[model samples]
Structures are given as structure tokens and as C-alpha cells.
Target: MDNRAIGRCLLFLGDVTEPGFAKTAFGLRDWARERCVGELRLPQATVSAGLPQLTCEQAAAQGASALVIGVAAPGGGIPDAWVPALAAALDAGLDIVSGMHVRLDALPALREAAARSGRRLVDVRTPPADIPIATGLPRSGRRILTVGTDCALGKKYTALALSRGLAARGADVSFRATGQTGIMIAGSGMPIDAVVSDFVAGAAEILSPAAAPGHVDVIEGQGSLFHPAFAGVSLGLLHGSQPDMFVVCHDPRRDHLLGYPASPLPSIETVIAQTIALGRVTNPAIHCVGVALNTGGMDAAVAEAEIAAYAARLPYPVADPMRGGPAFERLLDACQETS
Candidate 1:
């Protein structure tokens, strides 16, 4: 489904300016702005308590026909404070789109509110009904997986950029999203992390097939191999996608894992090596094709210097897709050579 068909306008409820939990909201805002999918209406003012609060009428006045619960809170559950605002938005006749594990439809009040307002409740993390267990069978055509040095290191962004860049160069490319935000953008994809552990790989396998044959499937990578809590999902995605080539995504400034401040981030070389080794468990010839650097907090000079350093260290092409240089072309060229 086209992303534009999802909603006319969206009001992101959470503050994306916050430090850690802003990745999803920021990605959605960037994607929406780039595609002209309708305006993203942020709150003009905050409550005295500093939380974002807006009535449904105010949201409509701001041209928001839908309310997106964009904050990825701790434990993936909705905050108690957000309940009232969400209910108000629902009563105001705005559809609710949420990526949180807590489904709005599951809540008695929100369900009744939607019913009363005739609004739709969209749960982005809802798993598909027909996902089968992964057979680990060999799939045809070329596939590329984006592996990351840490969680939220721009893996999905790199995958999307690669898909668009490759398609622009006349390549038949398809992006397979493994997370909620990517699912929201692509309109169709399995939320791999939400699935039961037993079916995680199976979910990836089931989502691998392209609309037509011979397309390069650019499967989005999830949690890092180093993330203590989510490493299993990452491995499942790697094996399930059975990619022929892989791109390593990293943020040079991130010295430690996102939430685990004590766990230091591994080197780029270590990340690439681990990804290749783990990927080979399902596909023996899996290789790192390129490196995607996330320079989100870095200056122009620092980002460029970091990219140059990565290029010097790694044999593969290194680029920051967000900065938009020759990285896409170089990545596509590398993929073509590998294919």
C-alpha cells in the first residue's frame, strides 16, 4: 500500500526532541516531509507539566486527521499520562496510529472512544496471520541485509536510501521492513521483534518473496548483534533473509549501546566480521558489501572525516546516506559487482 494512502495529516503526540526515544518519530517526520504525505502537525504549546497535550478540536484545527503515538516508551507500553490526550484525540474524530506494543484497540476506553467517534485504530506492530515457520530454504535472486553496530544506528534509513537509490538507477529493488516505523513507511512488512521467538526467522522468510522475480530485496536490519536484549531477533533476521550481501550501519559518536551505558560499542571491523560470520550460518557466501555511517549528531567536517576514516579502514564503500553524497552510487556499484 502507498504510504500516502495511510492518512491525510498526522500529529505526533510525543516530543521528538528528547534524547533517546526520538528515532522513530524523527524518521517518520523526515519521511513524511520528504514525500509530502501531508503535514506533520506538532503541538504549538505544551502543558504546564511539559507534556504535550492537545484537544481533538485543536488537532483538527491544526489539520491533523490522525494522531500518531510516535514515542517509543520504556517497556514499549503507553504512558499513563498519555491516556487522556489519546482519548481526547479519539473523541475529536482523529484515527489513532500507534507503533507501541500496547494496542489501542485492546484498551476498553480507547476502543469505545473509537467506536463513538467512528475512527480507525491502526496498530503498526500487529503481526500477520499467515506467517509460517522458516524452512531455511534457499531463495532465488540477490538479497542485501543492513546490519548495524548498535540499535537505532540508522539501519532502516540506510535500507530505505539504498532501495530508492538502486531503483533510481534502474534496478528492481524492494525494501522489507522488520520494525514498526519501517512497516509504517513501507505499508506492508512483518514486525519481526513483536513475533514470538520461535517464529521470528519464519516471519523474515515469509516476508522475503518479491512481487516479481529477480528483484534485489533490501531487507531492513534490526537490533545489533551486540545488543544483549535483542541480539536474537537480529540473528533471526540475518538467517531468515539469507542475504547475499550485507551493509554495516554504525554511528561513530555512539561509544556505548543505546540504553546500556556500561556496554561499550564494538569497532566497525568487529561488527562487520560478526555480521558476516553469523550470516554465513544460513548463507555461506554472505559478505559485507558496504558501510553506512549515521552522523546524526556530528558536524559536517567531523562526519566527512569519519566517513573517510571508515573508507580507509574497510575495503568496502563507506558513506553517510543522510548527508547524500556519492555514497548511494558507490553502494549500488558495489552491489552490482557482488550480484
Candidate 2:
């Protein structure tokens, strides 16, 4: 495979390092393969070793076609380390994709540096208030299920299990996938009957059909709010569809225990409080599902306890879908009631 055709891809790992180096690298490889189509090679070139200090000379040494500089600032903090790295990557002759978690207010210097280095910059951030407002569609149903764009979040698995759970309970359920990779799975999965992708490509394949489904419509969000794939096009798709309910899938280890992105990630209590404040804007209610227990590195007990505690505080239920029976049933019940 030609390195140029493969599009040299590089990413800076921040809290992303905790997700496991191998998983993160492979995930990006899959992302490139799926999105690049026949234009580029499948396994994208990637390197990681903590968040390396980026410089023009160092970036040139990596010799990649594109670079994805990820600074895992969950609450939007930009490390001083990113500016030079962004400049270096641009000098190395690579296209740049920036995650939204980076402090947008503080990015002008980096943006200017990138421009001087002759690199294209892409930003992926979703304003909490305007995240779902991209569409004028009214709330069509009481119940809704949502999935995210990032692969690690496990949106596809959650959607499938939720659909099966709903079918088992005999609710009129319609599972809709709003991104390319997801639509592929929906086409093959027995649990889901309908699939849509291409809203990002300027087609309304997902929204138009979902607008009037008599039953509940479960839609998926593509990419992380900070990932390039989810920025402009994906947000537009979500806005047009106007999901009635939003389900946030997060890693409990990152959310509650490991203090993700920083040594002091807000506690579950804090998150709940903030969600209450934000929920009023997106929907009258919101649901959260923690997959930290299923994330393979933590003790099952820790995840179980966290889910139990978090579920109690919020208006929704949280569980370990890896258990696959009653846990999924609970999720379906929540979806039905909300729908």
C-alpha cells in the first residue's frame, strides 16, 4: 500500500491512552478503512507513547499522510503541549484533525500555527445546547434510543441488545442507524429491521424515514463530539432527525473511578447534577449506560456497584450489557417507558 494513498495518520493520546494502546490504534485503523473506501489503505499509520511533545522536526520524522492530534480534555481543557505538536504536524506536511474536547477558546494560537505550517485543520466539537438543535423535527415519540460515533463507546452492541430486548417485550420497535459503519451492521443484524447512513454525505436517508415511524425510533450518533467524523455533518444529521431521547454510553472507569482526562474527573454526583441542568435542554429526560464493567480492565464488581449507584440517582437505569439478560431487559424497559 502506498503510504501517500494510505494517508499517513498520526494521533496524540491523552486520557485516550487508558483505553489500551492496541484497541485505540486498531479502532483508528478501522475508521480509516471504512471512511477512506478504496482511496486509501485499510490499516492507517499510527504511533503512540504517552502524549509526545509535537514539533515540526519530530512530526516530519513520522512521515504520515494525515495526523489526528487527540487531547482528551473531557471538559474542554487544552494542554500547552498541543500547540507545538499541532504546529509540528502541520510542518510535517500532514492534514490535521482536532478533537473538540480541546479548549476551543484557546485554539487560535494553534490554528494560526497550523495555517503557517500549511496544514488543514478540522474541529469536532458539539455545543451542549445546540448539539441536537441541528434539526427542526419535533419530538415524534416518547421513547428513543441513541448511539454515539466513536467505536470504543460500544453504540452498536447497545443498540442491538436494546432492540432484542424490546422485541422480547413486544413493543413496536424501530432501530435506525444514522452513520455509515452502523448502517452496515443494521443491514445484517436480525434484531434491527432498518438502517441509514449518508446524512454526512448530504443525504437525508436516516431522518426522512424516521420522522413518522408509528413505533419508537432508535438512532445512533456517529463519532465522538471531538472526533472529525462527528463535527459538522454528523451534527446536522442529528439535528434533522431530532431524537426524542438521548442515551449516553460512557466508560465507568473513566467516568467514575479513574478520574479520566485528569486526576479529578467529576464524580457521578457531579455528572448527574450537570446532566439535570443540561437534560432540560435536550429532552425533558435523559438516560445513561455505563460500559466500564464490560471494558475488560476493571473488576466486574466495581462496574456493577457504580451502575447501581448511578442508576438510582438519575431518572434511568444503568447495567452491564455483557451480562446480556436481565440487564438488557432493564434497558428496554427504560426505553419503552420513555418512548
Candidate 3:
């Protein structure tokens, strides 16, 4: 299956009452709509928080070619209840694209369903073969990385936002996606965490330079230094990207790490300090350029005040890219100053 949605219409399956892992689906939908990746069909029975949701029948009727399990469900497995609807989508001739660590094709029932319907299953998290170890060689051109306070705290969104904002200002900017959602939208990227430990930094090194020599590569970061389980991957990306400038992506409302509530969230200062310290291990000149806030689930006034507070605290531009205006322009200015 083509990594790019292109002519295909997609039905995103994410309809839980409390969105946890499914939150990434919202980002995917937004990217698809903004980039015109393909048509998104909304189902009559589905309703999500401000996002269009579609049922299997509606998606098939609307010429949707694929049903994407867009959420990163807990334990990386599809919910048992979702299997029936996914099977129906397969019967309707829609392929499956899943980013979860669990491979849908490996499930006997789902595999049989796909075979019976002649549909394909694309697992984005499956690592590629023969990935090399990092050489730590220097590369040309300036690069920017989006480091987050916690996992899934809008690092990818910040990278995408900066890419768009810089391009609008007539700057040559390119985005390097390091996660599954980004790969789905950007058409190509290495699933860094899935790659072997030895190859994680190598993958980042390879991807960071794929952009044009003069264009600024806005690299998407993975995991968080505070995330105990995935911090190694974050360190590898920091070292491999060799970023000259960095952006801190954070959600001010989150007081604890997702799925790990016992772990208290670190201060923004700590996150920035740790990120810069790690980056300097490979490139001593790495500097943080700005902060991107994910002000979801906050009142407009409250969000504005919080963002203002962050800007005052940080020595650089801070803004929520979702609400574009002066903050976004300041972010672009910061990027240009580094470029």
C-alpha cells in the first residue's frame, strides 16, 4: 500500500469516551484535512470532540479505500469490540493501516478477514531491515528539533506547525517525521523506537539530512527524557539530528505524565535543561529557540494567560500553533534568527 493517502479516502477509527492513545488520531485527521492527503468520510453514528468520525458502512459507501486504526491504544492492541467493525470494513474492500505496536496482520482473525476480502494491512511500526549504527559524522545545513515535556505532548504538531509557519514566511523548510502519524502524512520516515537500539541514532542521522542542503530540517522528536521506558530513543534522536536549534513542546495543563500518573511532571525549566544537555553531548552549540504549547481542553482566556506566562518565563517565543497569530509569527522569527 502507498504510504501517502493520495487519492484514497480514509475512515479513522477512534471513538472512545475518554481519548488516551486515540488522541494521536485527532492530530492525524487534522494533518490529512490541512494537507489534502485524501477525503475523510464522517459516519452518521460517530461523534468526536470537534473531529469528524465515520462508521464502517458510511466510509465504504463514500468511496473510502482504507479504514485506519489511527489510535495508539493501550498495550498497543486493538480493542476487542473494534475487531468486528474492522472486519466489516475489510469485507467492504477497505484496507487497514495501523500504527500500533501490535501488528493487525499477525492476528489470525484479522489476517483471515483481509485475505478473504483481498485487502492489504499496513503496519507503520514494523521496523525496516539492515539499519546501520550511528557514525556521528557531521552534516550540512541547520536543523531544528521539537523536544517535549512528556510523551505525546504535541512534539510532532509543533514540528509541523513550524514547518508551515516558516514556509509561509518564504523560508525553505522541511519536516522530518519520527513517528507513525508523521510518516503517514509525510509519506516516508523511520519508526525510530521500533528500530534496534544501535540503529536508532543512525536512523535519525539518515533522516535529518534527507532534506535539501539549504533548507532548515524541522525534525520531529520522539518520547521524552522524563519517560523512563522510552527516554533512550529520545536521546538517540537528540544526538543524531544534530540540531542547531530546538523547540520545547509541552501541554501546560498536564500535571502528570500520561499513563504514568504516579510520576509527577517536571518543570519546563528542567525539560529544557535536560534536552539542551543531551543535545550538547553530540553538538555543544545546540540551543533552544522557542516553546510550543498544547492548550487543549483549556478555556480561550485561560489558554491565552497560560501561554503568556510561559512566554514570560522562557527567554524565547512561546505559542500554541493551533491558534495562529502573533505568537506563531514570533516563533517564525525565532526560527529565522537561527537560520
Candidate 1 deviant stretches above 4 angstroms:
1-5, 15-17, 34-65, 210-213
- What would the per-residue lDDT of candidate 1 be over residues 1-339, giving only the tens digit for each residue? 233235544545453345456555556666654321332324532212222345557657756677776667678887656666677778877888888888888787788888998988888788877678888888877899999889988899999988888888899888888888887777678888989888888898888863455679999999988899999999999989999999999888889998799999988889888888888888998988999999887889988898998889889999988787776579778877754
- The Cα local distance difference test for each model comes to 0.77, 0.45, 0.78
For candidate 3, give the lDDT of residue 287.
87
| Two-way TM-score contest, 2 vs 3, winner | 3
The local lDDT score (0 to 100) that residue 251 gets in candidate 2 is 60
Q: Which of the two candidates, 1 or 2, achieves a greater lDDT against the reference?
A: 1
Q: Look at candidate 1 and tell me the lDDT of residue 48.
A: 23
For model 2, how does the per-residue alpha-carbon lDDT over 140-232 read when each residue is reduced to its tens digit? Answer: 554344433233555544655566566677867665644322333332111111112322322322243443445766655543333333334
Tally clashes: model 3: 1
Runs with alpha carbons beyond 4 Å of true place in candidate 3: 1-7, 34-58
RMSD of each: 3.6, 11.5, 3.0
Residue 158 in model 3: lDDT: 87
lDDT of 1 at 299: 86
lDDT string for model 3 (172-230, tens) is 88888888888777767778888889889888988877455678999999988888788
Candidate 3 — which pairs collide?
A: 43-54
**TM-score of model 3 vs. true structure:** 0.89
Worst 10 residues of 1 by lDDT: 44-53
Q: Estimate each model's TM-score.
A: 0.88, 0.45, 0.89
TM-score of 2: 0.45
lDDT of 1 at 50: 26
